[model samples]
Target: MEKNEKYLRAERKVRALKGFYIHLIVFILVNIGLFFIDLIFSHDGMWFYYPLFGWGIGLIAHGISVLGFGRLFDEDWEKKKIEEFMNKD
Candidate 1:
């Protein structure tokens, strides 16, 4: 049972990491396309930075959520929280 749980958690972490990578790739590709579009079509002011900045912030948050800042919310922390909740009256 413990091994199965570990496997599941590992799978979840792998999925999250894969998702972050995919998001990163998409952000890069789309931004490159947008840069060229803005460069060719617009001459008044540079507007590509709007979506780039907004999406970049979201990407950073996604990365932080997946990678985590430290061991603050790791599997051990999750197990502790689960036990704490289960033992509550």
Candidate 2:
């Protein structure tokens, strides 16, 4: 029973880590796409600055969603960490 629980916990951790990586990749892709779009539309220079500014804002929002917020709770990764620590004794 204990071994099965441990395996399940590890599986959950892997899934959560995978989710984090996916979000990171999405963030990078969105930024890159926006940069290219800005480069193309900014032929007039300052006009494209707004999009770049918006991109910065979007980045911040994404960071908050992925890192600052309680996304860790959704993954239950911290709970597993605590359990492992408690079992160390």
Candidate 3:
């Protein structure tokens, strides 16, 4: 049972990491296309930065969640919080 749980957790982490990678790939490809489109059609103004920066923020957040920042809120933290609240009651 314990080993199975560990496997499940590891699988979930891998899945999250894979999702982040896919998101990154799409962001890069789409932005590259968008940049060229803007350059060809809208030469008078540079507007690619808008979607680039906006989607960039989301991509950053996703990367952080799958990479390191998410560790701060894992099962241990949840259990500790639950224990703390239980003790209060």
Candidate 4:
């Protein structure tokens, strides 16, 4: 029961991490393409930064969701660490 829950949580984490990586890669590739297009087509001003900034912000949030946001170090992990330290003594 608990083992199954742990495994499910691990799988969810792996899936989220993989999705974030894929999103990052796509963001990079698509932004590169957009940059080139903007360079060749738009002649008045550099408007590429708009999408770059917006999408970059989204990418940052995605990274935070996967890596930060304290999801990884939730209560379960904290309790495990506490048990480990208590057992060490």
Candidate 5:
């Protein structure tokens, strides 16, 4: 039982770490893309700034998806698991 619990915890931690790294990579890529788009297009006044604004919006959406939605689901799952473990003990 203890070994199984340890294994489950390890697996969850590994998955969370993998997701964190993936999000980091995606965030970096989006920012880089925004920079290039701004550099190439915004030749006039602040037209390119539009894309930056869009990027900001995208970041907020991503944050809600990742931190809010993801964490909410994870917390529910963790809570259920904890309840089950406690019941078993």
Candidate 6:
């Protein structure tokens, strides 16, 4: 990869990781706020878990895309394997 291309790829990855972190922070903050509101207003039934579990699934997906199994096919890994195979000649 060319120098600029490498920098661009790294920049994109950093941006994606940063976005995921921000998403997580927002999820936590919003869920905490909703839980409190539910506790004060309802107090009869726990309803926050609906959005909690729903959004939690999305958060998990985002985490997977950012820091989870998606790494198995990342560009750096692919290039390393390609180089390893080529060097066996």
Go through the candidates in order and give each one's C-alpha lDDT. 0.92, 0.68, 0.95, 0.90, 0.70, 0.94
lDDT of 3 by residue, 1-89 (tens): 49999999999999999999999999999999999999999958999999999999999999988897889998879999999999999
lDDT of 4 by residue, 1-89 (tens): 59999999899889999999999999999989989999999999788889999999999998997899858777688999999999999
Question: Higher lDDT: candidate 2 or 5?
Answer: 5
Residue-level error in angstroms, candidate 6, position 33: 0.4
Tell me the spans in candidate 1 whose CA falls farther than 4 Å from its real position. Answer: 82-89
Query: Model 6, poorest ten-residue lDDT window?
Result: 67-76
Best by TM-score: 3
In terms of lDDT, model 4 sits at: 0.90
Where does candidate 4 have its weakest 10-residue lDDT segment? 69-78
Whole-model lDDT, model 6: 0.94
Between which residue pairs do clashes occur in model 3?
none
CA RMSD (A), model 2: 7.2
lDDT of 5 by residue, 21-46 (tens): 67668766877787677678777654
Q: Report how far residue 50 has shifted in candidate 6, in Å.
A: 0.9
What is the Cα-based lDDT of residue 28 in candidate 5?
69
TM-score of 1: 0.83
Query: What are the TM-scores, per candidate, against the unseen true structure?
Result: 0.83, 0.50, 0.93, 0.76, 0.51, 0.79
Q: Write the per-residue lDDT of candidate 1 for residues 39-72, one digit (tens) a residue.
A: 9999999999999999999999889989976347
TM-score of 3: 0.93
Q: Write the number of the candidate with greater lDDT, choosing between 3 and 5.
A: 3
